[model samples]
Target: MDVDPAASAKVVGNMPPNISVCILSHNYAHFLRQAVESCLAQEPGDYRLEEIVVLDDGSTDRTLEVCAEFGSRIRVIPLPHRGFAATLTESVRHCRGDWVAFLDADDWFAPAKLRTASGYLRTGAMLVQHWEHVVDGDGSPLLPDPHPGGNTSTIIVDRAAALKLLPVTNEKFFHVLDDLGLGARMTHPLTFYRVHGDNMTDRATPGAHQEYMADVCGEIAVRLADLRITPPPWASRSALRRLTWHYRAEARAHEVEAALQRGRRRSAWGPLLRELASTVLAGRNYRDRGPSIHSVLTGRPCVRLAPSPQEEP
Candidate 1:
């Protein structure tokens, strides 16, 4: 694949690519190559893979070197560490396709990912996504299919629809629950989500995670207001309260783990009890809920309710 930027641009303009794949990287030099390779290897079918854009958000590692190795096959943008949200916003500007697909630096897509998604996206769907194979840092399967439609790596968004959601100011919330925010519930197992010690989710403290969730919920509220649609009874005030309780429960669960790590079994009991109580309360509140505010606003069902290996009894 000759990746001359000039020639590629000419080809893109002449042929008009069906999908543009964008990969965002910070410091994951070790995983960047694999991500890029996977995108490059996508097979063409109903839609052609028009371009692959790699943005390095001021990584101190050898990430730029890895991207340079790909040469003209990908458009590599070296940027300062302006954070994920900013990087994503800027990356979209460089995409030149009708549909945009995102691959996290630490994740990779299946060979048929584009082929599978193009079929649905061409049908006028605003967004399309698929299931993900969750693996450890070493690439060994941890959960064969943890999330059927929740991973951003699995998503393919209509370029125009994506722009409408962009310039997402909340750095913590942007790209975190993008699938839900864009209503990409329809899915197929077509991507890999790597879990590792250095992952953002793992690095976030319980308190930080709670704060991020709160911000996400607040954003959801604002979107709902914009849509001028009142949430149903199931997704109203009580639903928001229950969602907050779940975040608190997650925090308590982490505290219990910390206590156990310190060999303080007795100390862990308090947080354990609190976690259990919050879980019970949240469960009761969520019992009869329909689609959540996120679902309602995005006009898609919640992916959390999707069946996957992890959800199997």
Candidate 2:
């Protein structure tokens, strides 16, 4: 991303790690102010705040006017109406901080968010994600899930890594974490998520997450011609029932059922569409004899355990 050195912040001998915060907005002008102010109020503990900018993606609302409200403190970038991933690509091009933080126009950061991120800056992780407090339009607390979704608004990524990936889509990202480096999960000191009736979670159909995982597994299968390895016990029938215990992967369930239908190991994923349709009609449970789709397809370990005394010679 040829980060125009003239525009990026230069760190001298004793300066702390610096970060650029990017707020992605698309007509959420009503919520823009608090979002920007929340970032401005961040307590830069071990890091320095390089800049704060709004990547406005063709908002017909008074988004520019909102940025203008902050005077020179906030930089407003106006771009054509591209989708979120594409706008994220532009956001990387505009950042000068050593690290880049993302926030949704509908979300805001906690006071300690960046400070918490600074502690993890040297941990060699490509991204550091924290928890989120979900609230309604009135700013009242709503019951949040036990774990954060590792949403964009909760993430601060290494600028270089982000640039290399481009498009910046997290949808298939964590699914392919083996290709990228490590990602961290910070349990405390959260960011904020507002559910203004139109939240994506509210609109998504049931089993969406699991369906996505299944599709990702299927994609990995097609890309991999050399994925040869023995799946561990967890990929076996004995451990298969634990599927939903981890995450509700509806599509993975389908793949497992397909494998069970085949009754053998497959080199890669394929359209089990016909068999899948039959299974849904026949009422089958995929957990009984399903292999770990990730392990079988990606050839990555699902779990590592020490050799038991009974097996150690």
Top lDDT model: 1
Off by over 4 Å in 2: 1-15, 144-146, 171-181, 200-203, 206-313
Question: Which pairs of residues clash in candidate 2, taking residues 3 or more apart in a chain or in different chains?
Answer: 210-249
lDDT by residue for model 2 over 178-232, one digit each (tens)? 1233455567646887767544341223333434456644444332211213222
Runs off by more than 4 Å, candidate 1: 1-17, 169-184, 223-313
lDDT of 1 by residue, 120-160 (tens): 55433455666788777777787745566554577676676
TM-score of each: 0.64, 0.64
lDDT of each: 0.62, 0.61
lDDT computed for candidate 1: 0.62
lDDT of 2 at 92: 85
Candidate 1 least-lDDT 10 residues: 1-10
Model 1: colliding residue pairs:
3-72, 3-73, 130-188, 131-188
